[model samples]
Structure formats: structure tokens, C-alpha cells
Target: MPPSQELRRKAVNFKKGFKLKLEPEEIRKLEAVVEKATDQFTVEVAEKLRGLRVALNDVANSQIGADQAMQAIRSLSLEIKGMGGMFKYPLLTAFAKSLNDFTKDMGVPTPIQLDIIAAQIDALYVVMGNRIQGSGSKIEMQLLGALEEAARKYRHH
Candidate 1:
């Protein structure tokens, strides 16, 4: 057998409790399943992002109770942070993390902070609506940079 095959065989036969390695055919089958799941997830994420965009706008405009808005944003941001990578949208994850950090324990954000939040929400909307995946494209880079600058201006400490 070739060296690679020999190595794979050895790995499979190792006495220790290592996980079983899939044969080449099995690996291909598993990859197809993963691809299908990823595609479905991508489709689902668009709707979720649209909902988040609406919620974020509502939170921004709410004048009665900032706490309720904060709570809603917290939930949405956390969900985006957790799910963005699963759907192959790391830029969404990054934006969500930033928004999450900014909103942590923030009762009512200052006007400047609200501006930063609006920028983040808009960026996320653009990315999700356009179906931009991974780390985002060139235009996304510009958008993220501007949003980050706005965020930095309001970051306490």
C-alpha cells in the first residue's frame, strides 16, 4: 500500500480510543451532507437577519424603556454571534460581537453610541441582504472600517 494509505490504516487500527476515520467514500458522502446543510442554513439566515434588522430599528427608536430594547438587542446579537459562523458568514459574527460588547449593561446609549449601533445594524443588513459570506468583500471592508471607527469613538476606557 502507498505510504498515505498505510498511515491511514495505522490511524484506523491504533489501539488507543481514537475516533474511527471515515473511508474516502464515506468522507465524500459526509461532505455532501454538510454542504447541503450549509446551503439550507444560508437561506434561513437571511430571514433571521431581516427580523433582526427590524428589531434593531425598533430598539433604536424606542423611547419608553431602554431596558427592553437592550434586552432584545442582546438576544439578537448573541444569536448572530453564535450562528453567523455556522452559516459561513464570519463578518456577521464579528459585527454581532461588537454590537454585543457595546450593548453589555448599557442602559440607554448616548447619541454617539446610537449612531455607532445604527452603523453596525446597517452594515449587517447590507451583508445579509446581499448574501455576502465569509469575511465579506472589498466594499464590506470599507463599511466595517467606518463602523469600527464610530464604535471606537464611543468605547468607554
Candidate 2:
């Protein structure tokens, strides 16, 4: 089976067995924890962005093997993607996933492809720095659409 299909199947199976109801108090506590974590994440957002920049630099400079660089980019992308929504910046998640998919689909990228990746990363940095919120606002959607276009355009090359 394709990896995507297999992953979907596993996700379905996992969700099927994951039925838990949180009590009101427990829900409140969990929300509070999430809020606190989000706040802390905001404080360190620049550091996280720097880490991503470093990963991209390593890939661009060929300082690391392609496979290792890809892994690092994938790891950072997943981390940002997974946490973005939790912190109320779902656009960041979307952009990060675009970045992750681009890296995965492009294999060892060409210079042009690297430029695309860097563009996405820069866009992400803007979103994180500004704390853009929700799934997307009008301006955010426009920005995301542009990023998506760039990804699509380069993905086929």
C-alpha cells in the first residue's frame, strides 16, 4: 500500500479506539495547560524559526547529507505544523505542511526548489512573528494562496 493510504488507515483505526470524554473540570484544566504552553511557545517563536533557518541552511549549503537534511526539515516541519493550530495560528500549520510536502515531494531539491522552500519558511516566519490567528483571515488566505501557488509551480519542476 502507499504510505499515505497506510497512514490514513492507521489513523482511522487509532481514532476508532480513542473514545474518551473529559469532565468539565478536567477540560478546563487541559485548556489552561494548552494556553500556558501556547504562551510559552510564543515567547520562543523566534528561536524555533532560527532552528528552521539553520536546517534550511544546512540543506542549501550541503553541509549535511541530503537524507539527513531532509529528515531535519521534516522534523521541524512536523513540529511547527503540529503546534501551530494549538497556538491559534492554523495558517502556520498549513504553511508548514506545504513546506513538509514540498520537501518530501521534491527529493533533493534544485536551487530553484531551495528558493521556494526558503520563501515558504520566510512566510512562516512572518506568520509566527506576527502571531497570525485562526485558520485564516482574508489577508492570511491571500498569503497562503500565494505560498501554495509557489509550491505547486515548483513541485512539478
User: For candidate 1, what is the total of clashing residue pairs?
Assistant: 0
| Per-residue C-alpha lDDT of model 1 across residues 40-68, encoded as one tens digit per residue | 67666666666666666666787676677
Q: After superposition, how far is residue 138 of candidate 1 from its true place, in Å?
A: 2.8
Kindly report which residue pairs in candidate 1 clash with one another: none
Candidate 2: how large is its RMSD?
Answer: 7.8
Which structure among the candidates has the greatest TM-score? 2
Cα lDDT, all candidates: 0.74, 0.80
- Give TM-scores for every candidate, taking all chains together and pairing residue i with residue i: 0.70, 0.77
In model 2, residue pairs whose N, Cα or C atoms come closer than 3 Å (at least 3 residues apart or on different chains), thus clashing, are none
Which 10 successive residues of model 2 have the least lDDT summed? 10-19
Q: Can you tell me which runs of candidate 2 are displaced by over 4 Å?
A: 1-20, 23-25, 43-45
**Model 1 residue 34 lDDT score:** 66
